[model samples]
Target: MRPREASALDALPALPRDDDGPVFAEPWQASAFAMTLALSERGVFSWAEWVDTFSGELKRAAEAGTPDDGSRYYHHWLAALERLIAEKGLADPAILVDARDAWDRAAKATPHGKPIGLSPDDLARIRDAG
Candidate 1:
């Protein structure tokens, strides 16, 4: 992590973490955190904006009766990232949906215990959409 970005992340209040820093129950949770950090480093949005949007997502989810046991934390993280990127006109919600579908197809096509790789058709659909 860049020094500046690391410090900015350190400043976030109420982050779910231990002494080792952010605790993720799944690999995708780690990925979501890293992706959000990368986007923020690239100036997609400020940390302040991220905090606000993420808090809103958590708040809304709580109000909607989602679990508070941290199982759904990264779900809200991904949702917030998508909303922020779309709000900034940096990404299209539909294209994101298409990419997600493509990923699902790729995962379904992969054999058990093998790395998931996108098929040519999946790649084509993604590139075409972009």
Candidate 2:
């Protein structure tokens, strides 16, 4: 693993990994992981803060009756990343909500097996390049 990823994993001991590196079951999971690492590297939030927020998310999920069977690790990860982004004012929380809603609308509009395409206006509302 690269030095940064190694350091990230060191700080995130809960992360699932193997001999190669962190294991992600989905592409979006990897995106969420990378985005968190990038944000931390840029000093948007300290890794300690990330850990605390992520731990809180996991705790919340468990309290809500979700089991920590590793199936939803990335779900908590993404939730934590979203909370941090909103807490830091990097992006408006409403924009994220709107984006999610827009994606749902677009997906419902799209036919089966084809790509889900959002409207230009919805796409324009996206602030992050990622």
Kindly list the per-residue Cα lDDT of model 1 for residues 8-121, writing each as its tens digit: 767755645446555787798899999999999998899999999999999999899886666687999999988898899986778788778878887988888999887888
The TM-scores of all predictions, comma-separated, are 0.75, 0.69
Q: C-alpha displacement of 101 in model 1, angstroms? A: 1.7
lDDT for position 68 in model 2 = 79
Write one digit per residue (lDDT tens) for candidate 2, span 1-113: 55654555577437554565557778999999999999999999999999999999999998999977787889999999999998999887677778889999999999999
Q: Which ten residues in a row have the lowest lDDT in candidate 1?
A: 13-22
Q: Which stretches of candidate 2 lie over 4 Å from their true place?
A: 1-22, 125-130
Which whole-number lDDT from 0 to 100 does residue 12 have in model 2? 45
Candidate 2: global Cα-lDDT? 0.87
